[model samples]
Target: MKVWKSVVSAALVSVLLAGCGSNAGTDNEQNEVKAGSTVNLKVFVAQPRLKEHYDKYIEQFKAKEKADKNIEVNVQLEMPPADNAPQILKTRLASNDAPDVFALHAVNEIPPFSKAGYLEDLSNQPFVDKLLDSVKPSVTDASGKVVAVPLETLSWGYLYNKDIFKEQGLEVPTTLTEMKAVVEKLKAAGITPFELSYKEAWVPQLFLPLTVGALTQTEHKDFVEKMNKDEASFSDMKALFDVFDLVNANGTDKALEVGADDGAAAYATGKAAMWIQGPWYAETILKSNPDVNFGVAPMPLNDNPDDTKINLSTSTSLAVSSSSKNKEVALDFVNYILDDKDSSAFYEALKFNPVAKVHTFKSFPWVDDALKYVNEGKAYQDPKIPQAVKDESGKALQGYYSGQLNQQQVIDALDKAWKSYNKVNK
Candidate 1:
């Protein structure tokens, strides 16, 4: 499933490390280390929110490596802001200053990075066989080469406060019409209908996957392929404005000033009944207010009940840079992420969904809430939309919300972006 393909973008490569060129390692840096030698490994990831958990895991890996191999591994973790990470990483890779290890959205990033000869082929790694069947495809390239370690396998949708829903006697809506009714009832009962954080282009841009996934899977089956071929237009799916307009009209005020972190705090505190977000932020939400009773539900995209399916996919994944001087140590760390004995606790501590067979922890209630739809086959794999197109959609939607553009202008922008992307990619 392409669910997690482009969900989270790749992280930045620290400019401070630019002095350490891609070929910085000596001839002896190739993993056959002498006893008591020290190896420095630079690691980068997109989610700065999970730094604490990652730090703990790296410490454990360090201690274990010292004990088992008589070698010291110095791991430098780099986490830049998510909004600009992808562009920075692109520049880093182009300059041959790639990190030893980094996180990327598996499906969307792997192919391009692999074509650029920037990714190591992990198809033969020990952890490849241990991945869950459902998640294997996300990290596998067209040649069946598994290029990354899949981390987050998400069954996500909008988050709703169970307490508020129950208190207001509201059921999860399965269509846009029902969703509108739910909004009115929530407003009547003195609760904000939605939590909107449009300050970040990526936040408002999430509507693309939620709406396009449902549409392509059912109503507009050929949409992505046609768009890729320049035979289709965004005007075909203009109905997306329905949910966009509805939520924008009823959500908490001053949305353009609010970012995801603040929006999570607002959602956790019950300032709004629903938030159009994925479970990837559950860690941040629970940290802000542990007592918040929340559950995941499909975002209603249209009047058709079938279009309200949950989004099931993978998010961030770990990969070793093929150009790294310390390939051996980098691969070891990637394998360590899926270690049979330590992985369950690691994933659970991060509140990430299980992505490998070694994961044995019980999932949170919200995960199960989303799984209820997945079990019923009421979920769709994320469509393979071009990253440039997705980026354009997010920026265009942000403009639409701020009154700088209208629906037609947004549609025209997306169509133009798609054609430009096709020209370059071809």
Candidate 2:
């Protein structure tokens, strides 16, 4: 889901007001508006790819609010790039100018914000009652408080072109050895085996965290704990490098230079037979080539078929600001979006899988397949590693892919980085 990076400017904030609506009254007046008066609630979101869906929901929610509570809901939408959103939101909250409502990652991203008391606790909110049982644990904190409403439960895996697989008589590989044979066949047939976009450091870093899940299942369930205690090191986890070698060997020669959009284009145009990504990229790929047929499977990280599993977690969630002047209205808006009727429309508009208990909605085949693993608890969430460690690990992987460092050197660097980060953060 780490797609783009762009600075959020003051000018962009000004533009968002025009996009939503004109400011009808003073900030204080708007905040203290009576039931019958028009009130504006600022909503900060990061998914630019789903802008149309958000726009539609804003209009729908406004109409519903006016009808139910006689208050005109003006939704000012501010969308920074996904990669820049977390820092921007943190800064805004710290400055006491937090958005009335905002989108955030459910796992690693939410803890610090919740600890700092920036998010409103929604544990007893009606929307929390509607969340699917499978998704409930993600939105709840360690203290069993529901801090955010689950938006989308996403899965990451290898996306393959069904048409190419069918035409070439290639079966979906469930093991690393099988995957290598498939890659060889694809390459022999003059098809790029994988679409790798390493220029976006976040993209390459994804596999590392995902591999942690597979490793936990097969080798060490307490790997993260041991690492934190300085009893374990990345050098001890050599299976990850083996998986990297397979991917790097089959990827496009210019992968290190390819950005996200370029990688999507290559895969959608049938230049590559597969791409490792999450369900978030499905819309973009389909938009690029409507005729392209694809399906998703867990990343085959090891030779044992049982060792591979999809990476699944709540990729995004919605929360109201604890300090919002219009907390009631903001909470109401959150409730409406998480409601079954409105939430279904929101997911349908964006073509995203629902995290709510909406049993009638049918997911894309790829998403449905990934959900099987999720239902069985075979999916993994990224460990709550520090952002600095994630950044360092990504750089190390880039070095490995670029032939600037050997596998052992990369592991040593990651272990060193982790120990240093732990000491500083502690």
* Most TM-score-accurate candidate: 1
lDDT of 1 at 285: 97
lDDT minimum window of 10 residues, candidate 2:
17-26
Clash-forming residue pairs, model 1: 3-313, 4-314
Global fold similarity of model 2 (TM-score): 0.85
lDDT by residue for model 2 (1-426), tens = 221212222223223223222221123222444778877799998877778878988898889888888898888999986546765876676556789999987876576566556677788888888888888888887678898887777777778899999989998888889998999899889988888888866677777777777778767778888887788887657888888888888887777788777788788999888887776877778888988988878888778776788877676888887777787788888888777676786776576777777534778888877778778776777666544455556667887787777887777766776676455334
lDDT tens readout by residue for model 1, 1-426: 111122222222222123244432322235476679899999999788889999999999998889988889999999986666677677777667889999887756776676556778899999998899989989988777898998888888799999999998999999989999999999999899999997877788789888789898777999989998999998889777988999999999988889998999989998998999988899999999999999999998888888889988777899888778888888889999999999999999889988888889998999999989989989999777766667667778888888888899888878887776666455
| All candidates: CA RMSD (Å) | 5.1, 6.7
Clashes of each: 2, 0
Q: Can you give the TM-score per candidate against the true fold? A: 0.92, 0.85
> Which pairs clash in the backbone of model 2?
none
Question: In model 1, which range of ten residues has the least summed lDDT?
Answer: 1-10
